[model samples]
Target: ISRQKRTHKIILPCFIGGRSVSRAKSIVNKDGCYFDFPNDAIRILDAMTRSSRDERIVIGKPVLRKIPVGTKIQLPYHIVERNLHSVSIPIIKSNFIAPRQSTPKGLRFPLAAKAVVRSVVHKRSSGAVILDIASRGQLNDTLRRFSHMFARKLEGVYVQPMAKPGTELILGYVHDALMGDVYIAGIGGSFTEDVHDIGFYVGKPDLRGAKAMLAQLRHTSIITSIDVPFVAHQIVRLSRLIHRHPEIIELDLNPFIAYRRGGIAVDARIVTMQT
Candidate 1:
C-alpha cells in the first residue's frame, strides 16, 4: 500500500534481495495486490517475519527453557559491592561471614546477637533471597540449610547487616526496541508486584525530571518525606549508567531504602546482554 494510506496500519518493512519492500497488503486496501494463502502457509510466514521496531518480534512465541543447577558457593561481599558500583547504584555495606557448610562456632553466635544480620543468595535477575537471623544459635543451622536448598538454583550466599527501616522504592531501566532505554521507578520491595505503581520515562532524565516522575507515584507522600533530592540524583545517575552501558539490558534496584539522612540499596539485580 502507499505510505500515505498505510500510515494508520502497522507497517513492517521487509528487506528482500538487498532492497526494502512491503510484502503484506491490507484486505481493505484494494490499491495493492493481495494474495490468498492457506492458514498453515500464512503461519509459516508469520514465524519467519522479524520487525525492526517491535520488541516482541521472534520466529515464534517464546517458551521457558530449563537451566542446569549447581551447588551454591559464597562470594566476598566487598567484591560484590565493588562490581555493583560500576553500575552507579549505591551498594549497602555488607560482609561475607562464612559459607553455610563451614560456619565457625565462635563467630556465628556473636555476629547474630549484636547485629541484625541477613543471609542472602544472589541471582542474576531474581535479586537476592534474604533471611533475617534472630539469634546467634540459629545462624549456622539456618545458613547451612538455606544454602543447600537454593544452592543449585542460585549463585551463592552472603551475610550483611540489615539496613534501617525506611521507604522502599524500585529503580530500573529497560531497553526498548523503539523507545531506546526507558527509566522506571516506584514503590518497591514486597509491595512491588501488589502495588504495580510505577512511572516510565524515555532516555535519560535530569534531576528535575526524575523528581517529577517520582512525584507522579501514588505513594509520593512517603517518598517526599525522605531525601527527595538525593533519590532524584540517584535516578539521574542510573539513567546515565544505562546510556553508557549498552550491554546492560535490564537493571533493578529493589527495596532502595530511603532514609531522612540518606539512601541505600538493600538489593540489586542486573541482567546484561552476555548473561
Candidate 2:
C-alpha cells in the first residue's frame, strides 16, 4: 500500500549503532520523515513475524489463589471489634450478652440487637437482625424473643448502641496464599450495589494511596461530609492488622460510619482459622 502523504505525531527514534537516529525525533510536518532498517531483510521479517502475538501478556501481581483451610471459625462481632480497637482503630461499642433480660454497663438506649451468626453478611435471617431498641425493656424482650425463636441458629445476642447517621463504607482486606494481603476500600452499606466502586492496594498503604482509594468513589457527600484523613488513616491502618494477626484470613468492616471529625467501624467480621 502507498499513499501520497501521511501524518504522524512523531517518527519513533531508531538507533543503528548508538547514534542520533533523527534530528530531535522528526515530528509532523508537510512531509513526514522515514527511517531505514539497515539490516538483513530475512532477520527483520522473522522479528516481525514473531512480534505478531499479544505484547501485554505479563503483569506484576501474583495470581489470586485461595488457601487451603483446616478448621475455620467466624470471630464474633465483639471480639472482632476488640481486636480492631486493640490496634487503635475506632469501633462502635458493643458487647455479647445472654438473651435473658441481662444488661451490659454503660450502654445507652436506641440500641440494636444483632444475633451472632456464622459468616452471615446480609439480612439472611430476617428476624435475627433487629435494630432500634428504644428501651432496656424492649431490648430484653427482643433478645429473649430472639433466643427463643432462633435458638440453634444464633450464638448470642450482640448489643450495640446505634451509630450516628453518616457516610457508610466497607473497608477490609484478604490475605491469600499467593497474593498475600490485599487491602481494599469502597463505598458500601445498604447502598453497596447502588454505586459500587472499590480501590485496592497491594502493598502497605500510605496516606497518598489511601487518599487515592477514597477519591475513586463516586459519592460526593463522602468527601464533603466525612473527614478524609480519618477515613484514609483507617485504610492505611489495615496493613498493620494484616501483619499483626496472620491467623486472620479475611477481615470485613461494613457500615464504617464516618462523621465530620471521626469514623467508626460499626460492624466487623473477622474470619480466622485455628493456629
Candidate 3:
C-alpha cells in the first residue's frame, strides 16, 4: 500500500473598510497557501501599508511630489495687494497704513466707528498687535504707544471691521495624488485643536451630502440653530471652487462665522502650486 499525505488548512484575516473582519480560508496546496483580496480591499490595504511612509497621505488620493526650494510661490494669507486679488470671497475693507508716515491733521479714522484694529507687524514675517478701538481717541493712543517700537521692522497696519460673534468653523481642501481632492470641515477657532472635531469627504459633495456630513457632528444642534442650509451651500460652493482651480493646492478658511441668517469667512489662507 502507498503512504497517504495529510494537508493542513490555513486561515487568513480579511479587512473590510478599515476594520479587520473574521479570518477566511485560503487555498492551501502541497507547497503553500494563497490569500485573495477583492480589488477594493487591495486599494485600502495599499493605503494602510504606505501611510507610515508619507505625511500627507489621503486614501484614494495620489501621492504628492517633493517641492523644490527657492520656488516663487504665492501664499493667500498675506496682506499684499497682489495676493488679495486672487481671493474671490468678499473681504473686510483694509488698507496698508505706511510706516512712519505723518497722520493727516483732523483726519477721520479709516475704519468703522465700532471697528477693531489688528496691527500685524507688516514685515515679511512677524506677530500681530491687536487693539479694540471704539473711537478715534483709542486708535491714536494705541498706535502712538506701539507704532514707534515696530516702525522700522514692520511694513504697515491693516484695519478692518470687527467680525460679529458667531459659531466658528473651518473649511478647507487638500489635493491628494490618488484621491484628486479631499475636503475637510470641522469646529474651528481655539477649540479646533482641543476638540479635534473634524470630518473628511472625498471629492465634491452636493448640498444633500454636505447636510448629512454636518449632521454627524456632536454639536449638530448648535450648527443647525445658527443656519445649516446656508453653511451647506457655502461648503458646496467651496468644493466647486477647488475643483475648478487645480493651481490652488490648499485652502484654509478658519473662524468662518456662522450666524442665524448667514456666515462670513473671518480669515482665509490659500496656497498655490506656482513656481
Candidate 4:
C-alpha cells in the first residue's frame, strides 16, 4: 500500500536497508508504496486490513516477547470501602448462626451455621471457591475440615454479608504480536460465554479508550442505565486499574457488581504471566 494511502495516522521516514530515507509523498500518490514496516506495526496492519483507516501511519511501540513479572497487586475495583471480613460476617451470621443471636468470629457459626468463603476469581468449583453458610453447626464443622484439608490455619477467613449479583467485566493485558503491550477487556465468569462481551486496544490505555470499548459491549446498559451507583465511574476506575498495572498478564473479575455508580467484584482472580 502507498505510504500516503495508508491511513493509520503514523508517518515514518521511509527506510532503505538500515538507513532512513525520505520518500516524496507525491511519488507514491495512489500507487502502492511497498516497504517493510517495523515488526511493531503488525497489529495495526491487521486492524487496518479488517477496517481501512483514513489517517497515515500509526507509530507503535516494539513488542518484547519475554516480559518479566515484578510486584503483584490485586486492584479491587469493587469493595473499595469494605474488606473481605466485613462481607463474609453477615453471610455467616445469617446462614450459619445456630447459637441464636450471633456467632463468634473465629469459632465459626453455631451448630446449624454454614461455612462461606468468597473467591477472588470466578471458578465455580476451584481451589479458590467460596462456600455458603447455612447453620452455625455446619459452619463450625466445615471450618475444622477446611483447616485439615488445606493444612493451614484459616486466619484470613472473613465472615461476609451476601450481596446481589451485578455485572461481570474482564480486564487484563497480554503480549501483542503487533502492538507490543496490549490491554484486554472482556466479560467473563459464569456468564462469560453468554454475555460474549470483550474488546482489545493498543497503545497506553486511557479513560477515553476504556469507555469507548465498554460502549461496544452488548450489555453496556449494566454500566450506563443500571440503577446502581458509580456505574460509569467504575468502568473508568477499571480502566485506571488496568492502566496502572502493566505487569498483569491476565486479570479476571467474574462478576463486577454495578453498585450505584461504583461496582464491586463478587469474585476476582488475577494471574501474572511475565517473562
Candidate 5:
C-alpha cells in the first residue's frame, strides 16, 4: 500500500466484474446486491469520503435510471412541447399536422415546419426542417416538398411561427451510463457544435450552479445584453426538468433565443426510451 493510503486508512473500492461470489451476501459488507454493482461502488466511495476529516456529500444522488432493454424512440416536437409547458421551458407556441391536416387558423405568417421522423435528427439544412414560410403559397410548396422528401418515413408535420431574433444560448443534458445526467450550457445556434464553447456540470441544478456555468463561457460579458439571470434560471429548470422525466435520456435546446424580457426555445430535440 502507498504510504498515503496507509496513513489515511482508505477503503479499497470493489467492482465485481467477472469474479464470482457464490455466497453473494453483499458488496458493501452485506448491504448491497450484485445487480447494483457501480452504485454499490459509488456508495462505498461516498463512505470513504465521509471518513475524511471534513465530511461532505460526494455525489448527492443518482439522476439517471438503470439501463432498460428496449428500442430508443424520440418524442416528437408536439408531445415535447406539450410536456414542456409544465416545465416552463419558454417554448414558442407551435402546432402539428400529423395524419395530414390543414394549417390551424390565426397562425401568423413567417413560420417553420419540421418532419416527424423517428430515425433522423431534423435540421434546416438537411431539409428535415424548413424555415421562413412568408405566405400561404410558400407554406403549401414547402409541405409538398416535405411530403415528397420524407415519403414513407414521414409521420406528420410540425408547424410553428418563426421566433423573433435574440441572443442565442444552448441548454443540453445527456444521461451518461457512468456519471448519470450531465448538463451543459453554451453559446448556441446553427454552429453550436462547431464553436465548441461550453461548460459541463454534474449534480442537481440551481441558480448558483447555472450562473457559474454561464460565467465559464468565453464571452461572459454577453450576459449584459440579455436577462442573464433568466437564462441561468432556465438552465437550472431544464436540468430539473430532465431529472423529473427519467424517460428523457438526451435533450437539446439550441439557440434558446434570449431577449431582454425573456427567452424562448426555437428548436428542441428529446431522445427517450420506448416504454
Candidate 6:
C-alpha cells in the first residue's frame, strides 16, 4: 500500500507486497455501522475481524459535513431583520425609548401614543390590536406582557392615540425589474385594503405626484378643509422618504395620524430589495 504520513516527509510504503486492496470499506463506531465504496477495504476487514465488545457504527456517505443547526427560521422575521440592518428610513427608533414610554414631543396624541411600532397591518380575521392604558403603570404592565407574546423582543409597541382620519396616508417604494424604482402614494390605515385608493409613478417623484395622489383620493375634501394641521407637510415628508431611499422594495405607512401640522407613521412596515 502507498500513502503519506507525518512520520515521513514523503510518501511511504506500508506492507509492501503482502497487503491486498479490497473494493469495499467499512468502520464500526459507537453510533452505528458505517460502510462505503471507494474506501479502504483493509480497514473494513480488520475492524470486522478484530474482537471487540458489541458496538454500533453508522454506515452512510463517504463523508458527511457538519452544520451548526439552530431553531427554525421564519421568512417574515428574516425579512424584518434584513430591513432593520440594511434599509434606511426616516422612522423613529423603537429601542430609543423604554417599553410603555410616552412618545416624544411633536408626535404626541390625545388618547393614544403616536409612532407605535405595530406588529402587523390590516386587521385580518385575527382582529386589530389594542394596548389600552389608563395610566403610566398600566402602560408599563401591558408593555411587559406583550413582550412575551411575540417571537422576538418587542422593540416598540403600538400606540392608539386619538387621530383624525384623512390626515394619515400611505407612502411606499417598489423596485420594478423593468422601470427601476417606483413610488406609490395612497390613503392608508384600516381602510387601506378595503378602499384600495392609491397612485403609482416611477423614479424619484416630485410634489406633483404626491398632490395628484391626494387629489384623487375620495377624502380629498378633508385636506382642503384645513381644520387640522400637518396635512400638506406630511405629504411632503412622505415624498421625501421616497426620494431618500431609491432601493426600497415595498413600504407601508398605514394609518399615519395627521394631527396639527406634521404626521407620524403610527404603524408602518418597510421592505427593501437591496437586502
For candidate 5, write residues 1-275 as lDDT tens digits.
Answer: 23323464433333232224323423232322222233434544454444434332111112111223343545435446655665788898766554345555666899988776656753655778888889878877877887888787676667789988888888888888899878888888876867788988887778998888877888766677778799888888887777777667888888688888888998787876523
Question: What TM-score does structure 2 among the candidates reach?
Answer: 0.67
Better of 2 and 3 by lDDT: 2
For candidate 2, write residues 185-205 as lDDT tens digits: 888776666677777777778
167-213 in candidate 1: lDDT tens per residue?
88888888787998889888888788889899878877998889877
Q: lDDT of each structure? A: 0.54, 0.63, 0.51, 0.40, 0.66, 0.42
Clashes of each: 0, 0, 9, 52, 0, 14
Off by over 4 Å in 4: 1-122, 125-135, 141-159, 175-178, 184-186, 220-245, 273-275
Q: Kindly report which residue stretches of model 2 are placed more than 4 angstroms away from their true locations once superposed.
A: 1-69, 104-106
Model 5 clash pairs are: none
Model 3 lowest lDDT segment of ten: 57-66
- Name the best candidate (by lDDT): 5
> What TM-score does each of the candidates earn?
0.59, 0.67, 0.57, 0.45, 0.69, 0.47
| Candidates in order: C-alpha RMSD to true structure | 18.6, 25.4, 22.3, 20.7, 16.6, 21.0
**Which residue runs of candidate 6 sit more than 4 Å off their true CA positions?**
1-128, 144-166, 225-244, 259-262
Identify the runs in model 3 with alpha carbons over 4 angstroms from their true place. 1-72, 76-90, 102-131, 141-153
What count of clashes does model 5 give? 0
Question: What are the runs in model 1 whose C-alpha is more than 4 Å off?
Answer: 1-80, 83-88, 96-100, 104-130
